[model samples]
Target: MSSPTTPVRRRCTLVAPGSDERKIAKALESAADEVVLDLEDAVTSARKDEARALVCRTIRELRTGRSISVRVNGLGTEWARDDLRTVGALDGVGIVLPKVDTADDLITADRLLAELGSTARLQALVETPQGVRSIDEICSATGRLEAVVIGYADLGAALGRVGGYTAERWLHVQDRILIAARAAGIQAIDGPHLSILDDAGFRAAAQWTRDLGFDGKWVIHPGQIDATTEIFTPTSAAVEHARRVLDAMAEAETTGAGAAQLDGHMLDEAVAVAARRVLAQTGG
Candidate 1:
């Protein structure tokens, strides 16, 4: 798990193929809050070993300003153990476990990393039906777990859905994952919007997730990073309002009142908490 003292922020997480040096390099240069070096789905089976080796070396030599994570193969796959054995040993890196279906999966992964003396944090990629059903348990399974990411594409395929981007289509699962993540006190990340060329659709999806209280979203291309960040980050106006709310609450406290009026709206402890959250999100 991520250390409580040093929080991991993921307003935009860019996914790059572990086997593609060019793409990885480009991803490292992007302004994405985090970059995920993928060894699953993106890399072919024939190059799994090569990709794993490449990812290990990249993690060891990484000097990027953003956080780094590696999406390893699923727990059922033959390559997963070795991927964990190697990448899980790297300190400060995030280990993204895909197709996480149960609490046992996380418990097992935690044990493996513990055995390796790894300081890497774990992020659960919940894509399967079983995984969604077990989402709450998975979130609380291990202290190593840092984030719960909703993998909508694979989840849609698994659920036999054929549809375009529609908020109504994914609302249930999105809410389910978000509630579970909040309950577990971890980050909730929305999956990537697959239509990379549709800038409007991408922004819409990012905005929808942000409005739904997701901490961030995944971006498959470097081109999507800036938009995702912009969509998730607190705006200057919002930050200023939050600061005013906090100041009003502080003034009320000095006057020995439990509540205050800010811009004609009543502000109480609950409102103050929300204001503080807004400031914290922007590091204000």
Candidate 2:
């Protein structure tokens, strides 16, 4: 019998890189499109150096599947510089940046990363009132900026409240962030759910985010990954319908098919495109 081979890339897209070596490695195997080995908020001030070293080595040693990212501390901090210096020296460090506030913040960080001889793609955090205020500038900062993660907890903090989903309000802000990212042609990963115990809230939030046109969301707890994966995965029924729509239309040699009957149920081009995207994501 032949040994099973590793996939060139895996299915998960919610970025969840756990703290510490063992759990982080476990997550890498579990299926996150990318795992950010967080060195900023997740790592306390005292353990910054330890996390830095661990991440740098993990870059060299982790199995190939999901992309590896490290969220270094903000600029102007001692640890931030060392963290950048260390991770920047290693290969396969995909993205590293501080919590961005303004265009200046992103521009300065992009330059610092370049100065460190890093070609890592950048991901900015749209977390503060200031950050959201300057969304256009931050989104337009540099072509190297590949993603903008909407930082819900931080945004809630800046709003002077302990945060949880208030659908009417937060959803509006999230839409703005998502639109900005889409306008810039960058991926949007909604911030992680801080509420570990409230799985109901987490799942609902994840589903709402997926509907909001976000490419993905951040995952803090491993428990959150299941909801992330479930909500985000394109369903089998949808996939089959998409296949039928495209196949039937191809045979008819027409386009822009709308809410018309297909196998006795209504189908539309809009729904068909969505299904096709799922197939593309699954490499079907």
Candidate 3:
């Protein structure tokens, strides 16, 4: 089993179909914080074998700065074992387990990876009703689990939610995912915004998720990368304010006070914690 470490920045996690070598090449050059070579929904059943071979080769040969992950087929499916066996042996690669509905799903995958003598991490893609409902357990399921991702399209379809993207429509599930991820101390990722041409809508969705404390978002198209990074990256003003909050609290601590005033608002240890988080997000 891979020892879990702090997840890399995933402000824009670009995914490419494993069957398409050209797309994979392009995604590697796109400079997204993370690149996912998808072998699950992105590949057709007939091409699963072909895609698997390509993904294995690509993962082995490629060299890039971004973190790499492979979205394996669901554990219930026939393809998942082969997918895990092939890629799980690749050291430092992240294994994205799609349609993960329970802690057992993760535990089973963990066992497989352990048997493979693999150093691969796990990312749970919670897309089904059961997955969302059992999210807390799933998040805390295994040490290999590094992140909890919302598979919005599949999740919405399973929940019978209709119409275009709306924050209100996913608020409850989103909040649940966030809370559970925080409890497990893992990264929370928002699913892809499928409307590739609707720049405005994409920006709005990224902003909403960023505000909700998602560490990053899945990006299906490279076009969405810039907006995603822009929205997720802390602003200069916000970083400055965070620094000020920390400075004020530190001064109060030196004076033997438990709190202080900053910009006419109370600043305490709790506020300093948030400030430090902001700086940490920006690597300040």
lDDT of every predicted structure (CA atoms): 0.87, 0.69, 0.87
Tens digit per residue, CA lDDT, model 2, 1-284: 11122211222344443347876777677656667778887777788888788877776787574577778888868876777667777675655575688878767766777898787666787778888888877887886677788777777877986545665568767877877876765666777776764377777777788787666677766666767866766678867867887777665456554535568766566666666656654557
- Per-model TM-score on C-alpha atoms: 0.91, 0.78, 0.90
The CA root-mean-square deviation of candidate 3, after full C-alpha superposition on the true structure, stands at: 2.6
- The candidate 3 region of ten consecutive residues with least summed lDDT is 1-10
Best by TM-score: 1
Candidate 3 lDDT tens digits, 1-284: 22257667777899899999999989988868889999988899999999999988887788554589999999888999999999998767889999999999999999999998997989999999999999999999999998999998888888888888897688899999999987787889999986775377888888898998888899899888877877888899999999999888878889988669898999776788678767766767
Clashing pairs in 2: none
Q: How close to the true structure is residue 16 of candidate 3, measured as C-alpha lDDT?
A: 91
Residue 259 CA displacement from its true place in model 3, Å: 5.4
Better model by TM-score: candidate 1 vs candidate 2: 1
- In model 1, the worst 10-residue window by lDDT is 1-10
Query: How well is each residue in 224-261 modelled by candidate 1, as lDDT tens digits?
Result: 88788888889899899999998988889899986799
lDDT of model 1 at residue 241? 92
* Distance from true location, Cα of 260 in model 2, Å: 16
